[model samples]
Target: MDDGAERIFAALRDVSQSGAPLYLQLKKNIEEAVKRGLIGPGDALPSERDIAAQADISRVTVRKAVQDLVKSGVLVQRHGSGTFVAPRMERVEQSLSRLTSFTEDMARRGMAARSQWLDRGIYTASPDEMMVLGLSASELVSRLSRLRIADETPLAIERATISASVLPDPHEVTSSLYMALGKTGHRPVRAVQRISAVNLGEAEAQLLAVPIGSACLQIERISYLASGKVIEFTKSIYRGDAYDFVAELRLPGPDGQEGEAT
Candidate 1:
């Protein structure tokens, strides 16, 4: 067995006992190794077969233990690559009560934000776009698609559509789309967002440097101006392990008063 397998065995020996399932004991052994600094982030773990042999446990148990760690974000598996300790990432907390751009959100946390543009141009509004943006069949819309990065780590894939009247040239948006719209007095002041969980597909997984089928948060947002005109329609996928969305709630008053406190 290799050094990593040997270490795993040693850790397993230290914690192995009767009564509990072997897989659970192995899982605890791995966690303890990580806590004691025996295994650090990005360190490759022993293969399932190797771990099973060294720990004298069934391969099925080893596999289950590893999979559980993956689901818990304690480990990461790369396609054609062995499992490894997950890289430590700073989780970003986003407030559901604010209408802020991704750039603005990162800026608030003093993190540098950048984008890799994938698509930018005007296209005939699709039926869905037309319905959402209140555009006619003949009207065109500007589309901007990009991979958003924070501190050089890929965080999200964002595709935003705006009325051509609001943004004549998508290419003009070199950084923040909201900033570009502000110049034309079409920046949205409010937005409604719906969030759901999805498994990353191959293309998006590759772009985000995550394994295929990794969990992610998919968000669809419609931004509106003070006049209630839809200014932007956006769809975004954020890394599940790297973001937290928070919302503050207030208790109702004696008379059942609710809504933002005055």
Candidate 2:
């Protein structure tokens, strides 16, 4: 065994005597190694058989321990490749009550945000887009699709649609769509968003560098101007492991007290 594997085996040996279940003990040992930077992210783990033989434990114990870590996002398994530690990802906490662009939010967190444009052009509004944006079938809409990145890490995919009259040219939007709309004096003042959990498809998983069928957050948003006109309709998919949506809640007050819900 190499020095790294030797160190891991030594750590495993130290935990084998603990009263905890063998699998739990093994899991804890691996976690401790990661915490101490003995095994950094993306480091390949020993094969189950090799680990079991060296640790004097059953292969089942190692498998169970590894599977647990995979579910907890500490490890990842590739179909053709061996299991490895998951890449460290920054978990962004987003406030559901606020209307902020992805660029603005990342800027507030001191992270550089950028977008890779997938498609941007004027297109006929689809039936769903027409319904959501309150557009007619004949209306042309500026469609913008992009892969959002923060600090060079892929974070989400966003597709937005707005009336052509509101956004005359989609190509003019080099970065934040909201910023582009601001120049037209049509930036949305408020937006309604619905969030749902989904299993990402193959394409989405590949784009996000995650395993197929990974859990993701699907969000649909309709933004309105001060005049209550639907200004934008957007659909986005975010990596579940990298984002947390937070909302403040308050209990009911006394009678005649007004409380706002966000």
Query: Model 2: per-residue lDDT, tens digit, 56-130?
Result: 899999999998777666777767798887778979999998999999999999999999898999999899988
lDDT of each: 0.87, 0.87
| Structure candidate 2, residue pairs in collision | none
TM-score between candidate 2 and the true structure = 0.69
Candidates in order: C-alpha RMSD to true structure? 6.7, 7.1
- Reference-based TM-score, model 1: 0.68
Q: Mind giving the per-residue lDDT tens digits that candidate 1 earns over 15-54?
A: 3558788888888888888888778787889888878877
Shift of residue 188 alpha carbon in model 2, Å: 0.7
Candidate 1, run of 10 with poorest lDDT: 8-17
How does each model score on TM-score? 0.68, 0.69
Per-model clash counts, in order, read: 0, 0
User: Candidate 2: misplaced stretches above 4 Å?
Assistant: 1-87, 259-262
